[model samples]
Target: MAEAVARTSYGRLVARLARRWGDLSRAEDALSDAFERALRSWPGSGLPDQPEAWLLKTAHRRLIDGARQSGVQARAEPEIERLLDELTERDDPDALPDERLGLMLACAHPDLDPTLHTPLMLQAVLGLDAARIGAAFLISPAAMGQRLSRGKARLRERGARFDLPGKDELAARITPVLDAIYAAYGTGWDEIGASESRVRGLVGEALYLSRLLTELAPEIADVWGLYALIAHCEARTPARRDAEGRFIPLSEQDPQLWDAALISQAENALRRSLKLAPPARYALEASIQSVHAERRVTAETNWLAAAALYDAMIRHAPSLGALTARACAHGEAFGAERALDSLEKLQGQASEYQPYWAALAHWSARAGRREDAARAYDRAIVLSADPAVRVYLVKSRGALLR
Candidate 1:
């Protein structure tokens, strides 16, 4: 019960506490203390009838205690007095005002480093640890941890407002919020774990944030396009692994297992985004998914359409991922030799990237370069973390040996 509350309500609780205490770092510390106490006490006392409320109350007390110990109680008296009054008036924890959006915006404040915005939001709003977030951003865990700590300190120093930005400021702040959520979703997509947080992952959390963004910023085309992209990817998740749990790449997945309703929702979202403006990076990516989704009814993948969408997306945001994807799509639509040539050009830039090597292996095999294919497969397998993907790669490499 305590664990579940922490997972679902951590952000809401932290947001409220930070708003009351006027300190993000302190709020997090107090909440962490509350959770630790709960773990020790709950096992003995059974359980609190209102776990979230109990947590909020306990953390609030901790904040007051900390303030008094630090000899700042007099200076913090006004905020404390306001908090005391508000706590008296609010009986239900569920009625606690949700300030998560404001908190997210503050984490993405204009004055902070733009690059740190997403990482900060991932840590503060989502409760993702630095190691996980660092993996997503390709930063060292220690470096990411230092960056997040510095971000919070910067927020405190700047006295970043914990309120919704004005209409004019909304557009400027939202991009990083979207980026953070997408990064979390990507982390969830590739990972499978035994821990509760890991097993639950950020996929559902990301989807919730995506839906909230659409409701909050209906005019933003990128917001809707991102939603469509995530939904389309999620719709096909059930087919990404076989019954035996081996990895199944997208092209070979059984469309019958795909969620029709999710596909429909994604298509509607894509339409809404395209109607608002021309196709951008995410919109083009969603269009590629839409083309892949057509195989459900059409029973044939249109590599040509997918290739064209990839080409357009590269023009908009020539990210390494997009470039690598373009090479794959172009190879499928054109020829394996052409794909190998394109991937070769990315050699120095993509030397450490696992997907590049994986794609190289695939194209190498198709191009009848057995030795090069085997070598690429070896590199891909070494770089891969997922057991299922490693298994699949091993199988693919074994076939080449035959």
Candidate 2:
């Protein structure tokens, strides 16, 4: 029962209640109260045969009671009332389960402030904590307490329709929605270091949105590109961190730990993306990931091939970040000398980060250019304070001495 409800969309649940009760505010309050009651009552009752229905009934009662007490007439839309009655009659919670997730997407629409939209989605759709949301946004935990309510009210004021958008309309909004999913994955992938639980939460959320979007818009290449990129990237999740909970670079990671299932799916998606009229960043990144993933050994990696991919990547999406990735790819494909040449092109790109210098230092030391490696390492040491990176520099300097 818990699993069923867990799989079901809380977004749909809230939207249904609001639509039926004719008051979003009242619907949310009643739902919260019902959930609280469920927690208190479930353990003693040994769980319900139909927990979702039970919760819905409890929320319904709360809504009716609150409406009567407040002297508010039942002013629900005629269509909404009809839908509510139909929902009331349906014995199966699974009948329209996917609607819940759709509600989540609608609530997180671009019309809302990005900062507030994510929090509201986390709360109403994902059931995330205020503290977590606050940390994700780098704010006071208390600030998130009413953010969902406020965001929802703003949505209500704008008459945000709960119904899913038409195909073209949905495709128009795909960019932000897809960005949200990618942001979630990065969140999860970076979590132990930043917002750990949230990182996982966002990964699941991304996949959920991907599945939802692809199902609705099967012909959309961007959506397929997103799913492919994520699928490719997630294959390395297990190898990303070690059993000791330390970061492992892709080159040094234990390839044995990668999830083959994700790789297989990624390959299929990559093919699908390639067949589309034009390739985008997602498709390009997925191809790059595939190159690394298909390698038999670190030495066997097609760095030159990867460099070419990154070169194309920068053209598709030019940024400092892209420059950095391309620089690393050059280091892999060409000799340290050529890679250093490539990186030198970005002398002032990120004067603060020094990824180029540090990488150049490692490459120089490995290529037996002690003096050059030491100089590059010194530059990196001055610019960056990351302990692991410092260790890498120190180790490079040591290797030069050896």
Top TM-score: which candidate number? 1
TM-score of each model, in listed order: 0.81, 0.80
The list of candidate 1 runs beyond 4 A from truth reads 33-58, 68-80, 90-96, 109-119, 128-147, 187-201
**lDDT per residue as tens, model 1, 324-376:** 88899999999998898889989989877778888999999999999999999
Q: Per-residue lDDT for 1-402 in model 2, tens only?
A: 444464454556676676554445666777778778877787788777657667777787776666667766556434444655776678786565444434555567667877665566556656666787676666677877777677777777776666556767766766666666666565333111233344454666667656565665667677778888788777787886567555566777777788888888888877887887377887887788888778634536788888998888888787665676787788777767776677678777656556666676777776777898898878877765345445545665777776
Local distance difference test, per candidate? 0.81, 0.67
- Residue 362 in model 1: shift from native, Å? 2.2
Error of 1 at 55 (Å): 4.7
RMSD (Cα, Å) of model 1: 4.3
Candidate 1 to truth, TM? 0.81
Show pairs that collide, candidate 2: 187-199, 188-199
